[model samples]
Target: MEIFELDKEQWKDFKLHFKWSSDKYYKVDIRKTQTGLMVELKLQTTDKPIVKDYEEPLWQQWMDEESDDEAQIFGVKIDSEIVGWMTVGMESWNNRLRVYELLVLEGYRRRGIGKLLLDKAKQIARQKNCRAIILETQTNNVNAIEFYKKQGFEFDGLDITAYHNDDVERNEVRIEMVCRNF
Candidate 1:
């Protein structure tokens, strides 16, 4: 039930979920034991490093995302295990403090881990005097859409083809989450 700042030492448990494309989805694993959660992936091959193509600089940047305290990232750990992660940052459109990427591991999902992460993020936002908590999710992630809705997030409307490329589509719908300070 405690949230800590993400560190490289926890990499053995955290991996990025990558969407190569709608039909060809794959999670690019970070196999190194140095920093950040090097999430164990079932799909990874034994002999090769986890990230083969988009490695190095991107890996460093991914690690950097864990701590932008002006915009912070927090990891939920129980019994020395990282169960979830969430972030609070500036929304690009309004320049308002927002909580964006939120994720709880697959097996850890539905155990209220996500709520714990969000609750911590909300406290952080209030401390920072943030306007609200905002997030963007793709239509394909129906479960997340529903979860956010139940958490009091309301549709601000949809963005047309917000993100799309030849290899992938970023047509994510944006939802706004307001955090009212008590």
Candidate 2:
């Protein structure tokens, strides 16, 4: 597989697909102590699998809203076909790189494409003198969580209401992960 900066002509043909199912989720517990607030993460498992998918693909919407000048997208190509892609942007105000999207085709997963994308993001961030690389993943995405951890990311924060009104009920809390060192 070859990794390259996404070309304009190659962007439209690549379909974005990120579908996942997991039986494990991180449960959040917040407590208040005299010094400060403490947040705990517990791994919880379910007998049945929990599936997650976009209501509609996000590529078109992202293309519409995010200008090419603002976001840098890297694509993994195999025989001229894009099998994986990652989008990242430098948040100047925060002095960090924000990873907006990272996805590999279902068949292309577990082959280091995601890691290559992340490595590209880190390289870009270092060039820009950013402090960290940040991204968000759902609590139910255990695979992604594990992968991020293996990639040297740590749990930075949590948003209990990041998604819909029933995010907590749906077991889809948004968990923020960050890699501070290159």
Candidate 3:
């Protein structure tokens, strides 16, 4: 497999679509405290597997056109077919590198493609003098969370309302994972 950087035009033409299933998810609970608030995330096993299918473009509609944030996209191709990709960008204000997206096709998973993409992200972070590498994933994405954890990332924060007002109840809370050492 060959991993190469994708130009803007190539990125525009690339479409990332994948499906993932999980039998466990994190249950989020927030409560008001005397001084502040207490937030708890508990791992829970679901009665049935939860599956999510997504299709998205490299450039999101919410991205600012005039902003200095420019994403660097990389892809892994096998036999001239794209099987995995990652998108990373520098967050100047936070002095950190943000992984916008990381996806590996279903049949191509478990072959270290994701790790290669992540290693490339780490390389970029080192070159940019980034303080850390951060990325977001849903609470229901247990596999992804485990993968990130194995890659030296820890839970940094979470957004209970990222997807909807009842994201926590829906088992889709947004979790922010960070790798500070690399």
lDDT, candidate 1, 56-165, per-residue tens: 11123343354344445578887888777765565434535565557776677888888887777667656756666666654444466667777766555344335543
Best by lDDT: 3
TM-score of structure candidate 2: 0.87
Please say which candidate is ahead in TM-score: 1 or 3: 3
Off by over 4 Å in 1: 7-14, 18-69, 91-95, 165-182
| TM-scores of all candidate predictions against the true structure | 0.58, 0.87, 0.93
Off by over 4 Å in 2: 8-15, 32-36, 55-69
Each prediction's Cα lDDT score? 0.53, 0.82, 0.87
Winning model by TM-score = 3
Residue 63 Cα positional deviation in candidate 3, in Å, after optimal superposition: 4.8
| Colliding residue pairs in candidate 3 | none
Q: List the residue pairs that clash in candidate 2.
A: none
User: For model 2, how does the per-residue alpha-carbon lDDT over 41-98 read when each residue is reduced to its tens digit?
Assistant: 8899988998877633324446435433477678899898888888777677678888
Q: What is candidate 3's local distance difference test score? A: 0.87
